[model samples]
Target: MTDALSDLARAHGVATAYTTDRGHRVDVTPDTLVAVLAACGVDAGTERAARAALEAHRSERAARLLPPCVLVRVPVGDGSGGRGASDRRAGRRGGPQDPGGTDTTPPLYLPEHTHAAVQLEHGGTVPLSPGLPPGHHTLHVRTPDGRQACAPLLAVPERLPAPARRTWGFLVQLYSVLSRRSWGMGDLGDLAELASWSGRELGAGFVQLGPLHAVEPGALPDPSPYRPSSRRFADPMHVRVEAVPEYAYLDASARPAVERLVERARQLNDSVLSGSSLIDREAVLDLKRRALRAVHDVPLSPGRAAAFAAYTEREGQGLTDHATWCALADVYGGAWRSWPAELRDPRSPAVARAREELAEAVDHHRWLAWITDEQLAAAQAAAVGAGMPVGLVHDLAVGVAPEGADAWALQRCLATGMSVGAPPDDFNPRGQDWGQPPWRPDALAAEGYRPFAELLRAGLRHAGALRVDHVMGLSRLWWVPEGRPPTEGTYVGYDRDAMLGVLALEAYRAGAGVIGEDLGTVEDGMREELAARGMLGTSVQRFEYLGGSTGRHGPLPPDQWRADCLATLTTHDLPTTAAWLSGEHVELRARLGLLTRPEAAEKAAAAAERDGWLAELARLGLLPDPGGEVAALHRFLRLTPARMLGVWLPDATGDRRPQNLPGTATVHPNWRLPVADARGRPVPLEELPRTALLRTLADVFADLEEESPHDPHDTDRAPDDTTENANANETEERHGRPGSC
Candidate 1:
């Protein structure tokens, strides 16, 4: 059984991107699991410690394939145990400081280390060395961490970097990027321009954009950018067609309708770009799709058609199936399942009947996709034109809707009896069901993992970098069977070997770097798995802190964290720096009664944590005051030293609205809100330069430090030439640029 478990670990490690370390194979069978741990230099003492650590996670009833293997570290010697608080110091001399009270700087602990490296599958070591050690250490080890992905902490040497070696990066949301050329929302054009400017001016190495995936055009079509239709495709709304070379040759008379559609899109974009009004993403997408369709019908030369056909083949049945669904839905109805039973099974003769009936619509949908694909290629091309490295980092969502095309098309591959969700955690105690279907792990391997691989290829092909959201999902997904609440969800493990291997294979070929968003409650050793596969991890400054200490919520100390990571200030899912600074998130959630019981205490504590973090920044002299506004957030972020820094698009513009409100769908505007300029005005792309928000954001982007590991401006002799940079232009006008917002 031990040998089997080690083999299984070797064969089934979940993180497709990070399954192996030092090229050392992982054994899933129990004995090999023990062996793998030993290979990591874990001795009998460490193994005994790991077993002791694993005991607490034991289940009265074991879960097949998933036996609470994760071991939350408990401190010994010092009599401390359980995941140690990430805070730097156990006690501080001062209390929280008030932003309004004074410009007093508070004490901050920016602990770091350069010792204790992470051993990878490729035989490379990830120097996790920090300058200062937390009261206790937290290390993630594979196999050794029980089924839960948790492992016991093993301390190594602590070698801190000199203070002068530290660096900082800004964070922003892409949609919030306002530029003279952008439509209402920020597009790739805006992103390119922003990256170029930021990379060059602020000396910023990388610029992070919001998830830029293809989305449906409709009122409130799930504004949470994370829940996308197709993670592989770029959102057509981000396409800046005018920037396309073909756009210049459209016959004058033939271009009128195209131009007219652009005008309407621009008009709709205005609702988002220049006003306090919420962005109607669906309206914007609808207009852009229509416009793109016109462009597609522009009689593509044989070469273009041939290229599109090749793309169609490359996108495979999934893309084609989705296109077919869109076409059928336009005429038959919104729900494909609700469509005539004959049309339900894509491979069925009934589908054939439906296809005949909706041939034109299907063709139209396919054409739209082709144009979207072409434009995406162009956008990547633009990045290359701008001399950006790691151009167009595409974000891959966690899962797909059960009723959506993926579920409908690959029904056999998905678990019909289960949905994916989270277990009870600090933030969401009730636990949460994401309402998306989970893949049948068994089915995935049987099918040669084609579905997952194909999806990855689509996304990676056009991107210089790709981010796997909730990367831990590749290891173990919380599977809540149908009719079960999220809390009842059990863990359904994947074939981690295949998943991570395929991901590495794809990434290796694409010449793209991988970043895993390993946030929230993660299983132990998950980070180790990712690090082993040469995948970068995500580290957020705001969430970094100590446990007992104030603001000790998440991964603390940039220096203490792993080096193969993207250091960021904020995320689209979280409040922007500006919003966080103003405490608007808590207030909004409170208004909605979203806080847990004893709401007042939670609010006060949360406020205290926020203030405590600010106080620390002041102490370090990173901020002028213990509590200032958004600027303090920026300065505070600048204190962390991570190699790859990601600046959110919205943060640059000081956009207050979060791209996503995790618990709220309809209650909160969510993804519907487009980025506006300062003073709450929507600043369209064309009008971006005119807006104070855009200027400030651009100024911020320009002022960031340059030459991050993932630099956009670096033009070394050898590289992929697809990434674009600093190119805001007319194509961006489709969203609502230069007008009305």
Candidate 2:
């Protein structure tokens, strides 16, 4: 690539070259660069276009007195110690003589004697300075050269709020954890019951669930929560119809149909628990929708009506847009790209007319959103009421489906002809196209990151802590051009400071903690930065080996683990603890033809790893003469100084199947299995408390908590504090689950 083109790419936050996980520097091709630039609304098809774009970019920067947005760091003590990378990006750090504040690192770019004031998010205006309070504020500035500008100003906390008490929680795939009360699959009622039982009866701290975002409305909508129709709204399919307030008020005409639907749902639930079928989301949705519509026909009480109105008003246009999309999808299909050109644009007059024509349908969808939100709030309330310090940790997926509600509604802010994905790496030599549209960085800045902030707000609304999937996307993402292989994608950078600042601000507002899934190929300093901002990182116990060879290396000792993370034995996409110990994962992979190596070799490697873990457990005295490997693993996790520990809910029942298998699509029944026991018998939520293994795992955590309380002082200890030499060959695993096909 020519220097001008390279410079233009850099200016636009497009990578010209990047280092692979294997340490090889692969230069992005000129064609790839141009295609990516085009996605970002820049024309770089030729040298002339590249030179012109670069000059224009430079000129724009030169003319701007204030950036599109400004980030203000609110310190720890008196708001002076919360400096972050945003400060450094703004301008050079000033010394003691600086006029802003004691910890004001980033000074303004305004000329000397410039006047500035900030309008806080809540209310009131104040002069822009170090004393500016934490909020999503607006900055009004007048430079000495007679230039004036305004920008979004974020004064965010340096770090997120830490968990009040070091505690252990259950990490669950909600759909898989069906209860007797569920309508075939797990619902919010099931979630509430689990949280209440675990928190009060089992002494658990929280329940971390997989993404519960709304899925597309269709017969065979993608089952993966990681790929959702709208992140802003909770999935209505997860709503417990029996729990709706209006259910009891159904008139005589509707009561019989509702009762029949309930009976049919009961049968469906029985089928799943009997292993006669997978969790049928489509059937469940159909049953619930009919029952919910019948309930919707019933007159709402005055109080309930007011509450629903307040919710719709608070949600504002986001909910309206989502409901409108659903209404349109019911007619034109889920993929808005195929919709009539006039109707595709959300803001067009045609949509306004359609929205009016389908007002009742829109209202029904809106009602669905409201009811889902109500259930989510109820679940969190139950957790907190049951004494969970960090009540519910909600998962936020990286991006929304390209053909879903969010993509249709926020078309202007998302890249039109690009998808978010991973570049070619060791684990995935072919790379992956996730088919989720990425946010346009330039558009995000131009729009003051309203969409991003809204997403965080929605996720954190009922969450005691929010777990961000692919958190590295906050800084950058691999952008694959339309119809191109993922291997041809290049990295596109986001304003890291602004992204983190907004997250911190929203999280702080909600009084919630943040956990970043910082696995896979993380950028240097990414973990440290997340830690600095009070965001926790994820650490899977099985992957935290000190070295490569199973016999020569040992599991990372408890004390060696990072204190600022949610340490667990495994995640949804990985093998369960029982499966890993028995080498079932290897066998399953071989059965599915997903193994690149011979089955024998893979099994041998898995066995070696299991034996190594057993040896470590025995050495640490965690393994008794007849102790269970699953309990021993929990005991090991308890020893880690990590602020929070996660017990995969399926592990409590010795489930061997993974909630998701990364590589295979239809060949493997991913995201459709119910939580089953060792013999593959589906275990209901009601049976969970009586299970000997579940109680045993609970005892493991309870015993440790009673024996030794966590020291808040040790919460932020670095993972390398122990004496073990962690010089393991860093072959990064594929970090996240693939987007649902």
Candidate 3:
């Protein structure tokens, strides 16, 4: 690649080369760089054009007095301890000077005699002061030339709030955990029940749920929550019609039709619970839509009507745009790009007219959104009311489907000819194309990150904690050009400081914790950065190992685990503990041709890993016999310094299937399996408390709680002492083999 092209790409935050997971350096092709730059609205078709673009970019930056956005870190100490305002001004252009004239702090960059002011997000305006509170505000600047400019100013806290103490919770795939009362799949009501029961009865601190983002509506709804129609709204399919307060007010004449739908739902539930059928989301949504339409016919009470009106007003144009997209999709298939030119643009007059023509349909969709919001709020309230310190932790998918609502509605902000995906590495030699459109970095900043902020606010509204899937996307994303293989993709950088500032601001405002899924191929120092920002990371037990031989690889010592994490036995993308222990995942992978190597080789590797873990368990004195592996694993997790530990609900019930198997979309039933017992019979939520296996697992956690009480001053205990004491207690208990805890 020419130096000019490389410089242009760098100016636009596109990396020319990157190191893969295996430590090999790969340089992005010149053609790929030009294509990506074009997608970002930069003209770099030739060497001359590239040089011109680079020069223009540099000129723009040099001419601007203020950046497009500014992030100001709040001072750490009280006003009395820091330098006085006059002293701070003296160091405005140079380093701060101490009484002895030594440079004490880094140089401040604000220009001299430049008028600066800030307009707070809530109400008042104030001069840019040292002690200003943390918020999303606007900064106004007047240069010496009398030229004025405004930028989005973020006054961010040094770190987010941490959990008061070590806590435990159930990590759930919400749709898979069905109940006898659900309409074919688990709904918000089931979520509430699980949260309340786990919090009140089992003392769980939270119920982490899968992404509830709205899926594309069609005859066969997309079952993957990661590729959603709109991240700003919840999926109505997860709403329980009967749980809606208005359902009780349905007229006598509508009761028969509702009963018929209820019967259909019961049959659907039976098919799934019997373990003979997979979750049919399309059928489930069809039945729920019919019933919801019937309920919509009933007039709302005065109080309910007012509440609905208030919600509509608060949501404003965003809700209207989402509902309008749904209405249009119903008319012209799900993919908006295939629609007639007149109706393709969301802001076009033709599309506006079409929305008016389908006003009733739009209103119905809007009502669905409102009801879903209500149920989500209720579920979070139930969690906290049942004594959970952190309630519902909602998952936020990295991007939206290219043909979905957000893509059509925010077309200007999404890249036109690029897809977000991962580059080829050791594990996935073929890489992956997620088929989701990435946000145009330039457009995002130009829009002041309004769309991103709105999505975050929506997700955090009813959540006590929020988990950002692929959290590394906040700093950079792999952008694959249209028609190119994922291996040809290159990394595109984003404004990390601004993105994290907005996230921390919203999370702080909501008084919630943030957990970043920093599991796979994270960049160096990313984990430390997340920890420093008070955002927890995810750690899975099986992958946490020390260097050693195949059959003897040592499990990472419990005390070595980071305390700022939500450690788990496994994640939805991986196999359950039972499956892993039994080598079921390897067998299934072989059957589906998903194994890149020979079946024997894969099985041998899996067996060696399992054996090593078992050895570690025995060394800790946590294993009395082979039958106690599950209990022993839980005991091992409890010993970790992780602030929060997550119990995979299916693991407790001895489920032997993964919720999702990455790479194979059609060959394996991903995201469709129900939570089942050892015999593979689906277990409903109501039956969980009564199950002996679940009760035993819960007791394991209870035993650990009894052994270790909260000690605020005990944060710095020696790792060796802690591990030794835990092992000693386990050895003592193993003498008599206490019944399951």
lDDT per model vs. reference: 0.53, 0.82, 0.78
Q: Give lDDT: candidate 2, residue 464.
A: 94
Candidate 3 deviant stretches above 4 angstroms: 75-108, 547-552, 625-627, 703-741
Q: Write the per-residue lDDT of candidate 2 for residues 194-281, one digit (tens) a residue.
A: 9999999989988999899988878655677888988889889999998999998889988999999999999999999999999988
Q: What digit string (tens of lDDT, one per residue) describes model 3 on residues 1-741?
A: 999998888777788888775657899999999999999999999999999999998898767666565666563332212221221231121111121112222333456778887888898988777666777677777768688888776676667756766778899988899999987789999999999998888888899998999989886434677888899999999998899888998889998999999999999998998887999899898999999999998898899899999999999889999999999999888899999999889899998999999999999998999999999999999999998879899999988888889999999999999998877755566666777898887777666677888899899999999999888777778888999998898888776655776787788778888998865555545666677677888777866754311112467777766677888998888888999999998999888887788999999989988998888888988888433788789889888778888999999899998888775566777788889998889999989999877777777676333333222225586445432222222111000000000
lDDT digits (tens) for residues 125-201 of candidate 1: 44333322222123232322233222122221111111112223334456655555555566666666755554444
By lDDT, highest first, what's the ranking?
Answer: 2, 3, 1
Q: Show the colliding residue pairs in model 3.
A: none
Point out the worst 10-residue segment of candidate 3 by lDDT. Answer: 732-741
TM-score of each: 0.68, 0.94, 0.91
Ranking by TM-score: 2, 3, 1
Show the lowest summed lDDT stretch of 10 residues, model 2: 93-102
Q: Which stretches of candidate 2 lie over 4 Å from their true place?
A: 76-80, 84-107, 547-552, 703-731
lDDT value, candidate 2, whole model: 0.82
